[model samples]
Target chain A: MGWFRKKEKPQEVVTEKKDLWTICPSCKAHVYKDEWDKNFSVCPQCNFHDKINWKERMDILLDPGTFREINDNVSTADPLEFKDSKGSYAEKAEATKVKTGMKEAVITGRGKIHGIRVVMAVMDFRFLGGSLASGTGEKILLASEYALRHKYPYIVVSASGGARMHEGIISLMQMAKTCAGVARLKKMGIPYISILTDPTTGGVSASFATMGDINIAEPKALIGFAGRRVIEETIKQKLPDDFQTAEYVLDHGFIDQIVNRKEMKNFLYKVLRYWKAK
Target chain B: MNLDFEKNAPEIEEKIAELTKQKATDPNAKVDDQIVGLKKELDKVLKEAYAHLTPWQTVQVARHPNRPLLRDYIAGMCGEFIELHGDRCFGDDKGIIGGFATIADSHVMIIGHQKGKNLEDNVKSNFGMATPEGYRKALRLMKLAEKFKIPIITFIDTPGAYPGADAEARGQAEAIARNLTEMSQLEVPVIVVVTGEGGSGGALGIGVGDVILMLSNSVYSVISPEGCASILWRDGSKAPEAAEALKITANSLFKLGIVDEIIPEPIGGAHRDYDGTLQAVKQALLKHLNILRRVSERKLVDRRFEKYCRIGRFKHR
Candidate 1:
């Protein structure tokens, strides 16, 4: 008799009592666990985007079983030992790992995209505010040197908020250091491709994002040096529609091309092939 | 809401309408000829008024909302531009836009300050104020140009590098200094053109060139007039007077031997005649490129260094 009663009340009816649904921060729509997972953490109803962690991005980007990260053991030091609302530099580093599951903001290594040899550097927005600190800058410089030494085409998948605020002046020096390295690579006649992902803003946009041999952006990515709101406030004026979108940038002649996620690997491979032929 | 023009336009229109009605009533009236003569006199007065413009007025012209920008020049002068981003170590800056484009059938690296056309674009470009990363990106692109043996052309138009807490934290001053040093030694012909306002270290960071050109109406100065006024006189209002004293106008700079040539603009201004301004720039670019092509890489670099080093010296009697 009890079994028959349980069968009469379905699992959906049982779950209805539990309220197992969460509203998405971006889209303001209710999302179930299965729906969120299936959509790759993207909102299914409105396509509201979220920042994906480094490891997940690597899995999506690199060839299967081909990502061998270099310099994972290296961590940031408090050369100045600065303090803030969160904690000291060292404490923040530890907290970043627990929160984002990545050791640093940038991960660098040699990887294959459709059997084309390339040195890759990716900025993880999850770790330490996705800012360019001394460690992050060092990682980029090291990656550039690696690409030049190995004679591999350099591909940087950037998604940083801006220059790292905590590391101060040292972080800023990284721009010059990394630029010098890139300069060397150019001297060697190696191709450097920069891929602008979602929310590639601030100091990062001003620098490496604008220095690529071929600059490519993701669809609907926000790419600019300063935030739109900041500029509006400063100028005390209204802005035009479609300002700083990948499409708008393409129209304004700021970016080379806007590529979609699914077709990125093939596009990169084609470019690499052409470069090698040249 | 009553617009500002509503207060003045109606009176002028009423007077004109009244005069026209009177002329229509008499076929042999001389009123029409008299009106035409008065209009000509007004036009002459307007020209006379503009002829003796103050330095502050020139500054206003430099910052004109409709003035030509880097995007405008690139579109008018080059073919198939390719933009590069980021300094790789930090982030990409919207202020200093640098990349590759083909000008006159030769591939060249082009760098310039991009002030957004509107509010949102300005913010996106930090109102054309570059950070350490922006200068670094320029350094990177300049090196790339050197490597490729392609000439580097810089269009300087910036108020200055960002003077914010974040910029300082990012070593804005140091990055600019490094660029100043590195660009001087770059083994390629670097041409700098002042299309608009060329302000201070931000302009100088990417401004080392074998031949520096200025637009007829553009202005280049060590410090902005307002800034200079604020520092020297403790008042921003004195900027116009300071502008004249500083000799920042293209004509002044050319007279001082600070710039090589002044590319003429269309009558009224570059804004009024965009195509004509572009043609002037195109011809000037070709002429300079031709001159630079004859010189060896070693000579180009040496001359660029010498040219910059010789700026701002006073002769002792």
Candidate 2:
């Protein structure tokens, strides 16, 4: 066994060299990839919550091996036969599926967080910019429905640019659809904890992302309905550097807390435990 | 209020303009034949143009300055209307108008985005770009409709919600979000009509309804084609292409099941025939309102919830 481990060092070093560096956007520091992953992708220098895909997010937040995905079978179709300069939405969807290894931008499922069962739907920014389309919205609604039916708490970690432009009005409709889902969950007395990760904007911010009973945002997350450029152009004024950041929103009383990445799971667990005790 | 592509119809529009000038100057230089000929040519050109309008053309038609605005809809369709103002949480927003009115003897609450008809009004109303107060004003009116058990009607026509820093500071996203949650649970028949540019959260802020309808030439999209183009292609001139991809036309929305019905426009589009457009809209609203009124509040809310929930769903193998 010792001789075999020694022989594997050369191959392991090659893999590490290929994947072991990430630049921190905040501090502009080169971070060791392994160290970053070990810290749940939070930059050790500036503590920036580096953008992560849904799978990584789920693994960080959910109890090990406890995620049972719901609405995984539901998918989107090219209903309008939408085509852009790049290609048809169908081709883009296929490409995104291969790139993200997920059927949709959002992954909805039930999972355990510190032994507390909760239904969660985490958005994947890598999948079509984490834009909310019809499928993404439907998955969220289905997740909430599952929570309401089975009496489980709900949590959603949102990271999106906005609504899916390729899906058009079908995407816009998701804003109302997801909100209606959240409303039902609330009516059934289920608690919803919405965690806004880095860059939650557009239609998503204006809907279920902001509809949570307890809206939690990651530190420095960008959360707003309009892009900064759009706002600047509309108002004809320069905005503050910190405008639309999670801290700014928190100062404005829009969100409840700005939880750090490393403590997010424990914080959620504590909240769920409190609800359970009540 | 000419469409941007009207410039391309020189044989029709330019000839008509020139012949009208000729007639005015000569008082009768055999201009009658030319006028009739141009008119016929114009009709043919219009038919061809309207038959296969690109998505961006539909967007232009929806935003045609002469298109009947919210005030026209209220004045023409409502038997009587009492205008309501203010969100109760902030100053009144002229961009959104709400009131109590009767449609075909059925008491209903009418709310809509007001882009304002003239230059002065347009500036005053911010081109129907709603502030957070506007959404809150809508919520207040919706709640009143629920309290009185009156059916609710909303006319969506906005480029988008206002994107000013002040609006954001006041929680524009939160205001729009609250409307979505509250409207879904409101115990009344809610009907939404995409009357013009139903853009993003601005539209969905009051867009959730038991039946989502659209005007024949209206557009409802998550973002303006120009914005989408600029974001995706880094050029606003690519808006025509973006519009095609966005699928914002009422007909496209109907095919996708996002729209419940499409109210036909007059031959030259709604702006050319305000009275005709108003009458058609009134009839459609009354018909849908009658059918929807038969439903109990619980069923209406349930169906409305289920209708939106099922919008983008599909079977994937």
Isolated chain A TM-score, each model = 0.84, 0.93
Write candidate 1's Cα lDDT for B212-283 as tens digits: 899877887656777656644568787775676666788777776667899987654666568999889888
Question: In candidate 1, how many Å is residue A209 off?
Answer: 2.0
Task: Give each prediction's root-mean-square deviation over alpha carbons.
Answer: 16.8, 3.6
DockQ, candidate 2, vs. native dimer: 0.73
Q: What DockQ does candidate 1 score?
A: 0.01
Model 1: residues with Cα > 4 Å off, grouped in runs: A1-26, A29-39, A43-47, A85-87, B1-185, B188-317
The sequence of per-residue lDDT tens digits that candidate 2 reaches over residues B1-317 is: 56755545555767778888888899857888878987887777777778888898999999988899999999999889999999998789999999999988899999999998888999999999999999999999999999999999999999999999999999999999999999999999999998999988898899889888899999998888999898777899999888988888998888888888999987778887789999999999999999988899889888888888788877767
Q: Could you tell me which 10 consecutive residues in candidate 1 chain B have the lowest summed lDDT?
A: B1-10
Q: Which candidate is the best by TM-score?
A: 2
The sequence of per-residue lDDT tens digits that candidate 2 reaches over residues A1-278 is 57868988999899888688977888988988888889888889988888998888999999999999887887766666777667678898998898778888899999999999999999999998898987898899989999999899999999999888878888888888899999998888899999999889988999999989999999999999888998999889999999999999999999999999888999999888878584
Q: For candidate 1, write residues A54-104 as lDDT tens digits.
A: 776666667988888886654564443544433466787778778776767
